[model samples]
Target chain A: MTALKAIDKTTINIEKIRADFPILSRKVNGKPLIYFDNGATAQKPQQVIDRIDHYYSYENANIHRGVHTLSRDITIGYENARAAIQKHLNAANPCEIIFTKGTTDAINLVASSFSKRFISKGDEIIVSVMEHHSNILPWQQVCEEKEAVLKVIPINDAGELVLDEYNKLLNEKTKIIAIAHVSNTLGTINPIKEIISAAHARNIPVLVDGAQAVPHLKVDVQELDCDFYCFSGHKVFGPTGIGVLYGKEKWLNQIPPYQVGGGTIKTVSFEKTEYADIPLKFEAGTPDIAGTLGLATAIDYINEIGLDAITTYEHELLVYATEKLQKLQGVKILGTAKEKAGVLSFIVEGIHPFDIGTILDQMGIAVRTGHHCTQPLVAYYRVPGTVRVSFAFYNTFEEINVFIKGLEKAIIMLK
Target chain B: MTIEETEQEIIDEFELFDDWMQKYEHLIELGKSLPIIDTKYKTDDKLIKGCQAQVWLHSELKDGKVIYTADSDAIITKGMVALMVRVLSNHTPDEIINAKLDFIDKIGLKQHLSPTRSNGLVSMIKQMKMDALAYKVKRE
Candidate 1:
């Protein structure tokens, strides 16, 4: 057993932070809710909740088109969100950031646009074996449509991406290489900076699905130099239906719009209408206005609190959780990558992941159990699915203690 | 639905959850209300694959709205379908189109259903929506 290292120092108080989420205080099945499903949408803070409410109450109006006072206020709120995200991601320009529905929509936008322009009959797109379905499926659709080959980079036994294999897969014909910044299934934080650099050498554009990474770490899109970076707002305590896609200006200009609708056009004529610029060119219609406002508020909240503090706090929780969860009999931890972000995927011997999740739920311990949108990765490990306990900064060691005891009881009951 | 309506109707039924032992019985009763599924159509072709509980769903368009006939091998899952039907059954095509049906948070039921069962429920909802879409396209 690797000794659990003392966590990198953190400033935020977990109990104080936990109080901010109303749902965290509630009881489930007579026991307090021990939410461990941060991988699938996290519990929002009071600030985020209030921000959404405030938007609807005070600032509800369609943006971009209206000249009215309410419309201008709403439009400013929406664009301010874009600017906030531009800073949050540390992008080179605010114009580089375009809002979409979520991680899926962002990835699809790139696939639809870039593939329409660049992908041809015999080109290839390389994706890691550990990608979420959202990351894999869009590229797949493009390949199927254009008669391009879709190649996969396999993973090591520990569920980490085999960098050697990824290097081997890259070659002349690979037009695009897309991979997840962090494996949601295994919790393996890939060496994406290196991955991006390697693909760039081959002159292949890279898109990173940062749905898991952005929530846990500070991400600088320019520093990474990845051509495309995408993440969901909901995963980072923001509203659903709002997400950001950071694309290099050069690439975004070359790709066509993913959807054609009311807002995307510039000048409408009977014969042919011109399109708008980079950000507006992609956003098709009356967008999630309130959601964008709320998301911007969320970004502000996260920034004020600081990502360094959040990262250190979650790392401690992960170490504490991993050590305790590993100590129990019949427990086998998956994804022992040297670097990870607070996710503990494990399967109990002689118990199904579904059964484990159900039993834990009865004890008021919430966890995600199943393929987690990464069916290929779960299948690659030769298991049905593992019960995933992903921690956020708000979670505490006391909660982890209760979880360990509840897990013991569950295992005993199943036995 | 308004907060008042939710509060008023939420507790109108026999206790919110009376006895844990009798929970499955309530589920069975809920299952009984599901529109009739044609057994003749029972085959792997109609089976929802991702659910832990076996669910079989079939759909038909009735006067612009999609009517669904669904059944599940698991009793609890049948209750889940019943809950879905309560929220969804008589609603108009437009109403169905508008609702997102936050499956995880609402119903306090994902705890009862496996991820696969949840996925199956999702599939049933999607197929019903598709049936509506087909009806819309045909009308157009």
Candidate 2:
């Protein structure tokens, strides 16, 4: 239909793209793998795998202090990754991009550091109901420690943030507003630009958790003007244990260092210690050098494919899936926000999501079943959990058909 | 029948199905036929934790044998619970405590269940054995 027409056929060669991921060829339970668990973590392309392999094979060295050739080479690769990420998100400076363990770690860094500087007793911090535990817990910990109040921006029945409620929640005492750019479970692509502008109007900083958004959408941090943006590399076809936190230089300068160690220090003595500049200030200990290189390579892969194409193709998949799932008997699709991304969460009446998930797995389909790390959201829905099928650019129409058939079979067995 | 004999019987029955779908159908039938737990015992305390499905288990000792009744929100998990009950229910506390329930692997159900569901299965077995242990202590 009109949604299908939006897909750019000229840019994406789906068959060729699928070949790049080695795991796509795998078989489970005598059936071909139909991986719909991209929201959990995407399948890595050969380029990223080989990049990591190449790093270990040749460029295996700790970065930024050694005079040796391998160390120098690795340092370049690592810093180049920061630059790639900076460019990817269109941040003002490469120094603003801090490499962390992942989105969880990045959020924790901001929560720990920013709250120490900004949050005080009786202050308020804003977060949405749709945040992953990573986003929620860190702020909650800060709130608990500082005697600050954690205000939640409630969602409507359609799984969207009640903007009116959010506006009401913001006040002079509101220190920061942290929200997800795209909900991992609901696939609701939040109005971050508007949210950021609203917060900025009140002179409040906003941290956008872009873990789910980065993989499927075009994220320009400078354009959004979000104070801080963070995403995990693995969610975007890169290696694990690597993520980027894009913080505005001004905000980063104001916040204290997250951790203090050799790489993160300018001077350290028995009585006095001075931290290094912005990124290295936050980056404590030896980082995941190979993982960062892989991340850079993954970024290269995405750039080559083009985010417009990925967005278009993935949107088509989402539309197709939504239509087909809606047509199925007894199926109720959750998160019907007008603007959505890669995920589709649903439940069949009188059938447990786990049962449906198990049957789908038996048929070689991998769909995440359970609360999807959003317990509060699941609780709000009044269901145990949902069977979530999250797609990537490489996913095809045929796989969707297979998933539909498998789901139908599961419902029949369950019902 | 002996615990091993009962397990073997289940394994033999599962062999009749060629594919997972048929086996699942049979399992759903077993789930449908499982004895429902008494409403009084269906409290949160009786509910098994770590299961994707809500499972409530209740047991009582009669003449030193443990009698177990269980219920599950999901049909497949209900089937799994029923299978466990069939092998362990009406058996002596010591017998139930010592039972390995190898029929799950023998019937190839172990591989079919997802990791979380498998964890749920382990929890079910543990709860059953714990009930047996409680009965053993009570009789002592």
Candidate 3:
């Protein structure tokens, strides 16, 4: 409790941190902007923006193919980003990192490639009720194609995954378990370490959806021992169109390439083409070179501030927000997991979340109001959707107060 | 009233409000008064699924004109649905088809009912126009 008070917004000089994000200073709907939609995608910092500009300004070139100096130099920069991401995730090798469009693309790659190698008719892919559409759809696709069963891990009312159900679902028929490290809508941090170890015990591979987790927590893929870990660049204040998929060397090498093209080939004979090694094998066509550099810069930006500080600060904000939200009547909070990240989802009695979101927008505070791409889970709560306010480290106590006031205003307007 | 005149009237009513709160209050008031569609007509086929909310629209042509009725799960969106119903309902097919209701931008709630937001009103407008076109074709 003392530590919570100690980690106040003043501790980090919140204004100084807020200054790094240029858009934070701007107004929306004639009022100062209070962006609480970080769960959708985080706003980029100036450092990441400048790094992107610096890339295109002086370092624009095709990577991994050209014989020219610009091409060679840019290739180094791109691969160096891979190395940085590898180090950040504490992966064993750079080869373990494959750049994709984002988490969706990364999961699709694994679902397609891994299923092709391991899955068969009647084999089960274990997912939870709390999966985002990205995590679910791909596995659904694989199951539909191969006649494999998609076994769902149910959740309790608290939005935490039912481990008993998950354990029961894992058997000789189970091929893999793909799940989010944290629930997007509920903010519940799933016991993925336990989930992974359980699967590993059965010799089944597990893919961790770190899209939500990476921004909030410092992820160590090696420590997690997850077979595959995927996260989006934009979620962690990096550029869009770039993401990382970290797979163990054995799994990466075992599976065939999900996609194959220019960079994916070592030599093409039209008769039988030889594929490139681990990372390149999955990357087809020209990748987002500028985005990769920008992502590395973003990684550097977070590492400089340190995840430990961000985690503590964001936790304090979460507690502060939850307490404030609870003080009001007719406002019911969803996702009351004992262990949650800085996401607050709630529905006010007799008022639609969309109306609340619209009213909040007028007050210049941005919040997401919908199922948040986790339809089944949200529907399980028996509401159309929820108004969600997710946080980043740069978010402040003052911002939360403004948001609580705005919510009060919204409730009055909608009512 | 003619569609254009109805639009101007709506605009003038919105113009009296100095701030967003009053405008939204008027909208909520409008929504509260939206006549409920018959439960028999509130089928999935009649549903206009917005990304954020759902709207069920029922339209029937009488006396060579379209009579529009709609409902929404959200109150503010219902207000917008009410607006759409008020402006274009009870118009002849050609009048409904050719109407250019610019009152939306004038009231400054355009973003709330934007096509990108999938607020159902845009699609409802399209649906109204299509209903008019169907009646027009049937008459011809």
Q: Each model's C-alpha lDDT? A: 0.80, 0.91, 0.91
| Model 1 bad stretches (over 4 Å) | A1-10, B1-48, B52-116, B119-140
After superposition, the stretches of candidate 2 with alpha carbons farther than 4 Å from their true spots are: A1-5, B112-119
TM-score of each: 0.79, 0.97, 0.98
lDDT of 1 by residue, B1-140 (tens): 53233323533543566654244345456665666668975678777755444567665666665666677654445666666656655545666665566643443454444444544666766765666666667767
Docking quality tier of model 1: incorrect
For candidate 2, write residues B57-80 as lDDT tens digits: 888888778889998888888898
On residues A1-415, what C-alpha lDDT tens digit does candidate 2 reach at each position? Answer: 2344566487999889999999999999889999999999999999999999988987799999999998888888888999999999999999999999899999999999999899999999999999998999999999999999999999998899999999999899999999999999999999999899999999999999999999999999889999999999999999999998999999999999988887988888999998899889998999988889999999999999999999888998999999999999999999999889999999999998878988898999999988888988999999988999999999999999999988988888878
Greater-DockQ candidate between 2 and 3: 3
Q: Which scores greater on lDDT, model 1 or model 3?
A: 3
Ranking by DockQ: 3, 2, 1
lDDT (tens digit, per residue) of candidate 3 on A273-390: 9999988999999999989999999999899888878888888889989999999879999998888886889999999999998889888999999899999898799899999999
Candidate 2, residue A17: lDDT: 95
| Worst window of 10 by summed lDDT in candidate 3 chain A | A1-10
lDDT score of model 3? Answer: 0.91
Please give the fraction of native interface contacts (Cα pairs under 8 Å between A and B) kept by each candidate.
0.00, 0.68, 0.76
Residue pairs of candidate 3 with colliding backbone atoms = none
